[model samples]
Each structure stands twice: as structure tokens, then as C-alpha cells.
Target: MCRWLAYSGSPILLEELLYRPSPSLIDQSLHAQMGAEATNGDGFGVGWYGLDTTMRDMPDTRGPDVPVLFRGVEPAWNDQNLRELARSTSSGLFFAHLRASTGSPVQQTNCHPFRHDRWLWMHNGLIRDFALLKRDLALAVDPALYPSIEGSTDSEVMFHLALTFGLTDDPVAAVERMVGFVEATGRRHGVEHPVQMTVATSDGERLWSFRYSSEHQSRTLYVSAAISTLRNLYPDNPAFVGLSDETRVVVSEPVGSFAGAWQPFPESSYGIVQPGDDVIGDFRPREP
Candidate 1:
């Protein structure tokens, strides 16, 4: 339903990931190769970390320091401001999303990469029969955090649910619990399938990406082959020569047609990318 990319590594200009590739995220915004739709023009957003505002004469203002966000309710390819920002801003951990709203209104608030505190999240699929489950899920969120929700998208609800379930402390467990609750509630209402999602979240450092569905099939999700591997494959491609071993990416689709350069995440799986380790784990349906 949408297209997105999450990148982590040495600081680099946003355009390197959002615009430079043959079929970059911006290209996917207008001509997606694997998404359900060809265009994701509903809206777009980008989130990046900059040197802490309090830091002075920052050698590099980019990287994991302060989180900055740019969002607009306009086609990404047509946004002049996005183009300028992509060229000027840089970061080691960043997220870019192009939306094809699934029943949600086309507004800035409805864009993905919704943030709360130090975390940022984005989703590429929807919650089945959301209208039926919305109230139930809302009632379950911690009252103290409910007032922070600023939009009416299922994606936002999912984020808040994770926060309520201890996301800040144990993201994997919190998300599992949230999804378990969703599955249980949906089954009670006679919905055979109640979820379809490929979600990513970050707290300015490590990143967590998930792929799951109530049914067997889920949306497309991929993680880039390590930069070292890419360098070995394309020795002459100077673009990746300076990247570190920990540099990695998780994207909605392959940014280029480089065979074997992008690996499809296993169905019903989730991945965690830490400073030095990247791990993929199974996501089995929870028993109601």
C-alpha cells in the first residue's frame, strides 16, 4: 500500500538513498515495481538524526544525534523542498516513506514515520476491518499516552499500542504482545484475517523491522546485502567504498536491479539491526 526505506550506517546525504539509486525510493513513489499500487502520491515524510542542537562546531552535523523530520501532503517527486532537504541533510539512521493511503485522508498528519518521544515508526499495510477494531484497540491503550495520538490512522494506533506495551524497554516483546492482542480481538469478531503489515521502528539507534499477517501472505519486505558484500560485487562502484561494515538497509523493495544485492525477508519474520549485529527472527501467530 506504500513504499519506504530505512538506512543505517556512516553519515551520508539523504539523496544517496532517497534519489540516487536507479529505482530509488522517490522512483518507487511514482512507479513502484512491487507495491500493490503503481503510485504512492498520497503523501511522504523523511526522518533523520542530526548533531545535537546543543553541540557546537559539530565536525559533522549528521549521524545519530538529534532527530529531524520533514513531512508534507504532496507527491514526493513533485516537492521542491524535499529535493533540497535530501541534498543538504545527512544521517546514519534515516527513514523515508511515500504513502498510498488506504482509506485514510490525504493530509500531513496521516503521513507515515509517526513519532513519539525518541521513536519513529512507519507501516506499509493496513489493519483489517479497522473500523470494527479501532474502538477496542483504542480502549486498550494506556490512558496517559492516548492523548498523544495525533492522527486517525491504524499505523499510528499500532505505534501507540507498542509504546503502551513497553516498546521503549523491549520493542520485540512489546510488538509481539500488541499483535497478539490484535489477533485475539479480530478472531472474536469473526474476522478470519485481521492484519497485513511490514512495519519499521527506530529509537535513533537500533532499528526493528517486522513482516507479518493474520494470513500466510504479507506485503514485500527486504534488507540490503551488507555494504562489504556490495563492494565485493561492484568493486568499481565508489559510492559504497567508504561505508562501514555495519552499514545496512531495510526497504519495502529493492532500490536497484542488482541481483542478489537485496534479500527478501522470510514471510512472518522480523529483523533487528543493532550497531554491530543484524538478526532475523520468526514471527509465529499467537494462540488466542
Candidate 2:
């Protein structure tokens, strides 16, 4: 349904991830190599967090820093402003997505990389029979938090549902609850295999990426090799020369063709990434 990428680590210009690579997110928007469809041109969006600028003396304890967002109704490949912003902006953590609408309107509001407070979320798969399940899922959302939802897409509702299930306290558990709830609701309504997703969500400091579906057959999701391993593999390759040890990228497809630079995530799995090491392990649905 879409293609997306999430990057976390030392600060770097958005162009370094969205444009510089051979099969960058921009290129994937137009010629996706692993997605079911070759083109995802309905719309796109990006969300990133700037460095902590609060004065030390002030000691701001507000939750995680909220991210800056830029979404558009145009294809990422041709959005001049997206390119300009990518070339000029930088962040330690960011999410970028290109959409191929299934049923939602092709408007800015329906773009990926939906945000709430300090969290950013994007999805690349559909919730089977979402139309039958949306009302139940939406009703489960915290009424106090429901008013903040501004769009009419399953992905956005999914994000808020996770929040209602306690995403801020524990993302993995929250998503499990979300998927369980969706699947249960689907069966209750006679819809089979209720969910399919390869989703990424971040709270500015840490990123959680999941690959899961009711059938145990989800979309493609991959993670980059350790920067140190890549540097050793291609000592002379400029692409690996400047990357930091903390650099980590999770994508719907590999950004390049290098053999050891990327690895496929096992089916029914999820990964968590932070400033240092990253972790990957199995994923499975739980009771709602």
C-alpha cells in the first residue's frame, strides 16, 4: 500500500537518506522494487525532531520533544518543496512515507507519517475489511484523545488506537493489543485475517518497527547492516565511509543493492532501534 523509511542516529541532512542513496525513498516512491505495486504516488509525508534547544537553566521536563512535520498531496518524486526541505533540513530521527491510496482520499490529510505529541507513525499495509472494523476500533480510542484525530484513514486511526492501548508506556504491548483488538473485531464481524502491516512508530528517541499480519504473511521490511559491518564490507565505498556507528535505518525495501548492507526481517517480527545497538525478534498477535 505504501513505502516508508525510518532513520535514527546522529544528525544528518534529510537528503542523505531521502535522496542520496541509489534506491532512496524518493526513488522508491516512483519505482518501488519490493512493493506489490511499482508506484506509490498518491501522496507523501515526513516527520522529524530537531535537536533539544531548551536552555539548560530552564530544564524543560515536558514529554519528548514534538516533531516537525511536512506532508503533501503531491508525489514525493516531484514535490519541489519536499526536495528543497530535505536538502536543507536535518534531524537525529525521522520518518518518511509515500502513499498509494487504497480507499482514502488523495489529500494532504490522508498522507502517511501521522503525528501525535512526540510520536510519529506510518504504515505500509492494510487492515483487511477495515471498513467493517473502523467503527469498533475508533470507538475503542480514548474519548479524551479522540478529538485530536484530524484525518479519515485507517492508518491514523490505528495510531490513535495504539495510544489508547498505552503506547507511551510500552509500544510493543500497545501494538499487540491493537492488532489483537482489530483481529478479534474482524472475526466478530465475519472478516478473515483482519490485519496486514509493516509499521514504524517513534517517540523521537527510540524507533519500533513491526512486520505482522493475521495470516503471518506481511509486507517486506528490512534493516540496514550495522554501520561498522558496512564500513568493513566496503572500505572504499563513499556510501559507508561517512556513516556513524549509531546510524540505523529501517525501510520497506533496501535503499541500495549492496549484498551485506541489508537484511530481510523474518516474517512475523519486529525491531527496536535507538542511539546504539538495535534489536530484532519474533512478533505474534495477543488477546485483545
Candidate 1, pairs of clashing residues = none
Q: Superposing all C-alpha atoms, what RMSD in Å does each candidate have to the true structure?
A: 2.8, 2.6
**In candidate 1, what are the lDDT values of residues 1-288, reduced to their tens digit?**
999999988889999989998988999999999899999999999987655344546565444454677899999999999999898787889999999998979988889889886789999998888989999999988999999988889999989998998889988888888888888888888878988999999998899999998886999999999888898899998987999999888999999768779999999998999876788999764532
Model 2 lDDT, residue 285, Cα: 72
Candidate 2: misplaced stretches above 4 Å? 51-64
User: Which ranges of candidate 1 are over 4 A from the true structure?
Assistant: 52-66, 285-288
Locate the minimum summed-lDDT window of 10 residues in model 1. Answer: 52-61
Q: Candidate 1: TM-score?
A: 0.94
Candidates in order, TM-scores: namely 0.94, 0.94
